[model samples]
Target: MQINLKYFASVREALGGGETVSLPAGVATVGAVRAWLIARGEPWASALSEGRALRMACNQRMCEAEAPVSAGDEVAFFPPVTGG
Candidate 1:
């Protein structure tokens, strides 16, 4: 399946901005995607670490790790907000 992926803030810097990529089916959870991304090596591993402050959105709405993903969905990743 293919999904639109967006990276923001520090994550964008870490990931060198963004691109759309194809993800395998059954990677239904945010955690699953994170794990897959980390397996890509280097910056992905560091950028996606659980210890890092991160936030996600699915189809533009804030989402949790357990949020379900579908083919053609848009998923976004970014550092946690610091501004008030």
Candidate 2:
């Protein structure tokens, strides 16, 4: 399955705009995508680190790591927004 990943705001600045990843089966969740990216090391690891404050969306809808994903799905990652 192929998934499209999008990065926004700080996330985009760290990882660039986006990329497409081809999954080799057994990896089928939003979290899996994140884990895969994190495994890429360096900027990926630091940008999407587990301790980072980030928000995710699947197919343009806000979703959690456990959310199910499939081929052609678009997953987006962005840092939480806060303004006063």
Model 2 lDDT per residue over 1-84, tens place: 999999999999988999998976788889888888898898999999999988999999999999999999999999999999
Error of 2 at 80 (Å): 0.6
lDDT for model 2, on a 0 to 1 scale? 0.93
Residue pairs clashing in model 2 are none
lDDT of 2 at 46: 97
Per-candidate total of colliding backbone pairs:
0, 0
Q: How displaced is residue 65 in candidate 2, in Å?
A: 0.6
Clashing pairs in 1: none
Per-prediction TM-score to the true structure, in the order listed: 0.89, 0.95
- Over 20-75, each residue of candidate 1 has an lDDT whose tens digit, in order, gives 77887768887788778888898889988878879999889999989987888888
